[model samples]
Target chain A: MKAVEFQGLEVQYGDMPALRDASGSFETAAMTAIVGPNGAGKSTLLKAALGLIPSTGRVAFFGKPLAEMRARVAYVPQRASVDWDFPVRVIDVVVQGLYRELGLLGRLRLSHRRRALDCLERVGMADYASRQIGALSGGQQQRVFLARALAQNADLYLLDEPFAGVDAATESAIIAVLKSLRDQGRSVVAVHHDLATVPAYFDRVLLLNRHVQAEGPVAETFTPEALARLYGGLLPQLS
Target chain B: MSALDFLAFSAPPMLIALLAALACALPGNFLLLRRQALLGDAISHVVLPGIVLGFLLTGGASTPAMMAGAALAALAAAALIELLQRSARLDPGVAMGATFTAMFALGVLALELSGAGAVHLDVEHALYGNLESLIWFDATDWSALITPATLATLPPELFRMAATLALLAALCWLFWRPLVILTFDEGFARSLGLPVRLLSAGIVAAATLAAVAAFAAVGSILTIAMLICPPAAARLCTHRLGPQVALSLVFAAASALIGYVLGGYGPLWLGLPASVSAAGMIATTSGLILATAALWHKR
Candidate 1:
């Protein structure tokens, strides 16, 4: 079954079209990478699929509507977006993942708290679970956020630029976690920037600008023509 | 100050400080996380016009009118800032600076123009509350409707403070997930089917209420100390929102006590009246908290 499907998706921020007429289906248990240059709508596409941004299109998870499938999806945003100095411990940040399943006003019961710690252990961050998030290295912080996603135990995970600023070991660890998730029948879509790691990491690629240039198996679809089209220089302005 | 005397002066301030801290810290968390620290300064300054207008229309310092006016005015200031930023495409600081300064200036102008009965708010009074005055303000008149079998009873000021704190606590708890998600990642929060706009507006409104209520006890200027300092200090000390908020509360309560002691005792030694100096004490104490936390963290 399709894990995520977007049909005729269109997004705009005011008059600027971030995504236009994008359509695709992503299989569950497959690793998909969205690649593009700055302002290329890669993040916008992921956000739109997650219902994070306003869009005119249809997105579904496992044939169910996006709204109904929220609890099944976990999101890891770009590291730059979060306040690194926020006064929260690693365990505290991880526990935020279980918030959707537990009613917001509900207490963080012992079981849920234990599960949060377990997720941290899965990411090799159990020792840092009580440390303030601000004190962790970039990769360690990313692992804590990953632990948050793991705590959710969601079927679909959407990660935005998790590799940025992360160390090599952390990157490898993240890849291993993603691979494990795929092996366990979960869908993972990440917006990636490193062209070199594409072949080694992702099974599928979606090249985009304001619209999808190409998509499919990594080798079969990531063509030179598509790269040129997606990253072409902007037209010169007339004086 | 003796423990009894400290209790007399410190209790009300502590209660007010606790509510004030939450009001500021709750939204301050987002403001800090969102990198909108100046917004607190903006609201506090801009609300002056609201207070002036409220006084003008209601014709006095009655609690309801002053608070309503301040809330409306502060909200208007927030809306105005948003409009300028979105429609005008100006930087956030530019938008906030223009709107808040203008509103604040207008407030000063209105106060000067009115030439009516001398309103209780002057420059120093605007900066801090008269804690000695508060002690004589007779906060005991309001009655509580308690169940006979119930094991809980509280004084009038305590009841009001508790009720106000409860309202904010409820919102924070109920929206904890979305608020956390939004604070950490607005884009992700929105994607997860959360109503980001509505949630933000609700938070802003709560912040406004917290600001207005806080201003009544500590005055406008000192209210900001409670809002900005605790959360910031907590940020230096912790990373989780729960502990951060708890730590901020602890710091705020301690500051209240310190302020009361300094205010009550320093007059005899330093030749400054306690009532006139309370706000300074609180602000200095809070600032010290932030500085000390920062220094300790660095080491």
Candidate 2:
């Protein structure tokens, strides 16, 4: 089943067009890496898909439009976007994942809260449950955020630069989690920063620079020629 | 005072004080978290016009008039700040400063023009409450008794209503973890499929309501101090929201009581005016707590 499909997707900020008419389909149970340089609309494309930004185009998840498919999707934004000094416990942050499944103003059942704690344990953070989130290290905080997504229990996961600043161990752990999700028939679209890991990490790759440069399995589409065009050739000319 | 007096006397005041503390502190947590700490400062200052408008419209300091006026004007100020931030590309600080100063100025001018100049407010009394003055005022005394207790004694200052409202508001917040997440981390909160905008609007409304209710009894200018100083002090002592909230309430109650007593009696023994002297004492105490916390945090 197609997990995500973007048709004539375009995104803009004020006046700048971040992503132009990009179209593609990502299959279920596959790790798809969205890669591009700064301003390549890598973040914009994921945000647009998650309905976080206004874009003129059709984006669907599981054959349903984004608006309708919101409940089935979970997102983990870039770590830098949040304030570390926020006064909340690690569990308080994770419990937020149950918000969608619970009604707009509905209260969480005790059983649902237990599920949240269970997800925290899955992320190896059961001990950090009561600790203030601000006290956590970068990777630990990322794992807490990952736990929040896990609590969402969504069919699809959209992560934006989850490994921007992290230790290698944490990186591998995150990759393992994504791999585990894929094994469970869940889909994940990660906006990856490290170019070297593209072939090893993701099953398929969608090269973006304001448009769909290419889309196919990483083994075939990640050719040296495609890499040059996305990074070397287009970057200097645009700037 | 007798032991019975201690038990009976403090209960009512403590209850009111606790409620007021929570009302100011809970939303204060959000404003502080948002780094819009000064937003309280701006709203409290500008709410003068709203209060005056309310008094003028109703021909008195009635509850509906006062709260409605404050809310409308405060909301207007917030909207204006948003507009300035969006259109002029002004930083939030600059926008808030501009919006508040203008609203406050308008409020002062309106009060003077309405022949209430003699009663026109100064900022010091507006931000902080004269808790001593509230000692004599009781809500139960004024109306037909709702309960048997009311038949025997006068109700305390209507401020109890504000406290009760604060408790109700805080209870709402306890269930609204999703709302707090959105405020502190909008991106991730949205990713979880939370209704980020709706939750935010609800919080803003709650914060506004709390501030306005507290403004009626505590006064406007001091409302910011009460709202901000306690949370500021609490942040030094705790890292989690629940504890921070608890600490803030304690600080708020202590400030009000100590500030009230010192202002009332401190100047009688010394050679100072009670009102000014009391405000100075509360302000100094709150300032000291905040500074000490800051220094401790640095250490």
Candidate 3:
């Protein structure tokens, strides 16, 4: 079954069209990479799908509207999208993920802290739980974000440039977590920045510019010609 | 001044200033985090025209009318700023700068041309408030404080401020999670099925209410100062949201108490007969706190 499907999703920013009728789907239990060149509206597609921006589209998850499935989906925005200097502890962020269970006005109790701590441990961020979020490195902060997403206990994870600005170790750690999530029958979709890792990291690839150029199993769809077409012929050497 | 003297002359305005400061500081935390500190400043500025308009419409300077005017003005300013940022594609800072200055100028012009300037509302009152005038004439001694008749005679702004602060605190509790998430990250809050737009509007609403409630009694100087400085100082003191909020209350209260005393008596003790502007003193004290925190605060 498809985890998420979008048809003819259109987004216009000011005068420029960011996403023009981009349509694609992330199959359940698979790892998909949304790869594109600069200004390709890669993030726009996710924002539109999440209803964060106004868009005209038929988007569905598990054959239901996104509003119905919000609790089941976890979204990890680009790290740069948030202010690092915000005064919140590492653990406080992870607890933000438990909002579904905590509900509005639910006092944060020990059980919530324990569960949040567990999610942080899963991302190797438990030790930094009490530290201020800004004190951590970019990778560490990214891990905290991932920990928060994990704490959501979501079945579908949508990440934007998860590996950007992170260390090699963080990259591997993130991939390992995503792979483990896929192994456990969950779906993972990310807006990937690094072209070189498409084949190795993602089982499926969606080549996007203003629209989806191609999308399918990475072996066939992630071909050099498709990469050239997606990046407008300035394709990086795909060894 | 003696304790009795403080109770009689200084208590009412000081308490009012403290309540207003706390109220403004509460939302200041969220606004500062959202980088909308100038929104508070903008809302406070437009209150002049809001009250003036209220007076014009009502043909009198009734408290409710002026308050309604301030609230409407604050909402209009917020909408205008949003429009400038969205439709006009101006930067948020530029939008706020353009909207507030124009509204404030219009307010001053209205006051000059209109008869609203004849009453308690004026340029000076709008800037520094009638804080010194909000004295406790009924409280001649300590026993007067407990007497029901004397308590009933207390300035209406004191009750208004207290009620405003209590309402703000209640709203904060009810909307805590959404407010926190919305301030930290709007997109993620929307993704969480939290009403991001409503919360965004709510922040402005809270700020507007604060500016209106405080502006009449303490003026724009203290309102704007409480809306930025205390929370900013709290931000430097701690990176935890709860601690930061609590610390802001401390800073706000200290600023109000110390500033009111200094403004009321500092000149008297310095061989001068006149007191300074309490609103100015309060705002200045908050600034010093922020600067000192910036220079010396650890952790």
Candidate 4:
């Protein structure tokens, strides 16, 4: 069974095609890593699939439309996508994840606060809940974002570059969390940048370069030749 | 500065400025945080054309007509900015700058082309406004605070400003959560099924409402000043969004009070014969406060 699937998806930015007829699917209850070269429309693919940006074609989750499953899906965008300098506390951001349950004007209660703290605790960031988001290091900020995604209590998680610029400890902690979520039968999809860690961290791999080059189990698909073809031989390590 | 004299000659304009400053400052928090602070300046500028056009069409500056016109023009300017940013691939600041300058020039041209310039629609009025003349003659003393007839004689602007402030505050409180989330991370907000586009448009709409209403009570100068200055300064004073917003309002009220008093009576205290433009003074005071915040943040 597929967790999420897209067919013939296309995105154009001012006459330039960022994504071109991309068709792919990730299996249910598994971890998939979307690996691509720079400007390969990796982030654009996630944005388009989630309806965060304008794109042609449709995406479905669990054989149902996104609207029907929105409550069950959580997304953690790239940490650099937002202005970290924004005056928001770590707890406030985590609390935002509960906005759907909180309703439009629902006040945060003690229970809500406890739940948010629990999410922070899972990320090992409970102590920094009151600290400003901007003051945290890159890895810590990324973990805080993951905590926010966790607070949603969703069945599927979409993460964009979750490990980029993070420290080794943070990277291991994040992978452990993702693996735990997968072990619990939830699906995890991340736009991963590190070529060396693909097989070690992800069970499935999708090599995308404006379109899907190859996609299947990481053992069968994430190879030097596949990456060489996807990156047009630009990646020195692949050589 | 007798009680009666102050009530009759000064209270209305001062109160109007305060209310207008507060209203504009509230939305300014979101704008500054989202790096769209100049949108306030743009909306304030575009409202001039709307006001002039409304007056030209209606033959008088009716409050409803002026507000509606300003709102329409602000929406148009915002649309143009978005179009330029999306289609033309322009930076947000550059798009806002281009759109607002053209709209403001259109307003000036409309004022000149029409015979409205001879009336109250002059550029000077658009900038400095008739704040000094918004006095309450019937409110001669403290009794005027409660007397129905005396209160009825208060400047219409005072009521308009108060109503505008209340409406903006209520709307902010109602949509406070979505507003903060969207301002912080638009993509995450979208993933949450938060109607990201509508919330974004709502923010611009609220800003237009605040800018147009404030533009009516004070001039565009004070409207822009209070919108960006207070929020920008408040951002430096606090790292928390709620506290920053509260501090922005405090800065706004302080600027209004200090600037109004200094503009109105500082000349008298200095033994000068006349006073300065309250709108300009208010803008200056806001800038000073922003500078102070920057320095304090440095510490």
Off by over 4 Å in 4: A233-239, B61-63, B141-143
Error of 3 at B98 (Å): 0.7
Predicted candidate 1 versus true structure: per-residue lDDT over B33-121, tens digit per residue: 66666777788888888888888888878767777788899999888877787677889889989988999998889889995327675
What is the number of backbone collisions in each predicted candidate, taken in the order shown? Answer: 9, 16, 0, 0
The segments of candidate 2 whose C-alpha lies over 4 angstroms from its true place after superposition are A101-127, A232-239, B1-19, B55-63, B83-90, B109-160, B163-171, B268-280, B295-299
Interface RMSD of each: 2.3, 2.5, 0.8, 0.7
lDDT of 3 by residue, A95-145 (tens): 999998888888899999999999898888889999988899999989999
Q: Which stretches of candidate 1 lie over 4 Å from their true place?
A: A13-15, A228-239, B1-30, B82-92, B113-124, B137-162, B173-178, B271-275
Ranking by lDDT: 3, 4, 1, 2
Q: If ranked by TM-score, best first, what sequence of candidates would result?
A: 3, 4, 2, 1
- Per-candidate TM-score, chain A: 0.93, 0.93, 0.98, 0.96
Instruction: Give candidate 4's error at residue B54 in angstroms.
Output: 1.5
Question: How much is A107 displaced in model 2, in angstroms?
Answer: 8.1
- Clash pairs, model 3 backbone: none
lDDT of 2 by residue, A79-184 (tens): 9999988888898888888776675567678898789889888777888888989899999889888999999898899888989888887788888888989999
Reference-based lDDT, residue A135, model 2? 91
TM-score of chain B as predicted in candidate 2 = 0.79
- Model 4, range B1-299, lDDT digits (tens) per residue? 68788888888899999999999999998888878899998997888788888988899967788778898999999888878987888999999999999999998899888877888676676677678889998875688889998899899888888998899899899989989999989899899888877888888887888888888778889998999999999989988888988999999999999999999878889999999999888889999999999998899
Candidate 2 DockQ vs. native:
0.50
